[model samples]
Target: MECCAFCPTESRELYKCPKCDRLYCSLKCYRNEKHWICSESFYKDQVKEHKPELMENEPQPEDSSSKNFNPEMFEDYMKTFKKDTRSEKEKNPQIRVRADEDILFDSDDEPDYVRVVAEKSLEEFEKIDMNDLDRKLTMAGLGGLTDNDEQLEYLYSQLNDEEKKMFNRLADNLQYDEMGLMNSVFGKNLPKKK
Candidate 1:
């Protein structure tokens, strides 16, 4: 383990802050340290020194440009902005609520019928079985398929005992036909088998 930069006496057991590269022993120490506090004179001085360009490039309000801006263009811009904001908020609903509060604080108070329906849907989703090919394709994502046989062999070798058994079963069922196996695993049509 690395030693803490601030306090050499302490072990670097905590994660280093990506922004400052400072090692903290714990979240409490990170928050309580004089360097961490926003009100600290040294902290303010460091921020100003390190990010002088940011202060210099602060956006100035459009003085006369806003007056001359077309109403139609402004409407269109507002529409686009609203749509993007709505989508973003939908994706992260917790942002609209207070960070300290729970979003599903009353989840326990939900109706028994609603709870049953939700549980049933979750159970159905969990029951879906994935074949070996399906598993590989899912893991591959947009990378499509591996071209290197050695990489594929290495990946196969890395599988645990149970996974190895599954792979062997899949290969046996596939009859060692690479093209057919690829197609079956990815649920795509195979090219003409040579």
Candidate 2:
């Protein structure tokens, strides 16, 4: 029988913390201050997992040329963003206005799943306020560390002034690397029509 990782006792029945894979004898042990960081992270991951699937596998247009952009197809795909339950979007939407950029630039070779993830990450990244410490941590996917003051302080302590400033400036603005993204996936940039 393995002992609980948080409590100093051998346990016949132990549950593993989903985030860290640490054994704990009970909910109390799992929720203890010593284990709260991992527990909190596990909760956040659970919330994300429970969200509805963001996008359906909709068919792409038969034409491969960027000039053949279809507004109806883009509208249908934008509907997938409506699946998000986040209220911030409802209050102040940062919706992309046109199919001119993202949809038109999407490389034919890129998988749908990759494009979906990239779009979601960009939308979420744009919503972040870089000046806020908690939001910054969340944007960095270290939101769970917000609950642990000691860990957060230690993490900051590890960074020198210049690195700290640079980290703080992440996502200060969004710029699409259109040619770079398309070139990497398509092996050449598609020429923009004059």
lDDT of 1: 0.59
**Model 1 misplacement above 4 A:** 5-108, 111-114, 140-194
- TM-score: model 1 vs. ground truth: 0.21
Candidate 2 Cα RMSD (Å): 23.7
| All models, RMSD in angstroms | 23.4, 23.7
Candidate 2, 1-194: lDDT as tens digits: 99998779897888987678889898899888787667666775666678525323433444436543434444653543435455543544555545353332345546886889889999998997765867766789777454578787878899999988776654232222433443355645665222
Clashes of 2: 0
Stretches of candidate 2 exceeding 4 Å from the true structure: 51-194
Backbone clashes, each candidate: 0, 0
Q: Which pairs of residues collide in model 2?
A: none
At residue 8, candidate 2 shows an lDDT of 91
Error of 1 at 85 (Å): 39
TM-score of 2: 0.25
Measured on C-alpha atoms, candidate 2 has an lDDT of: 0.64
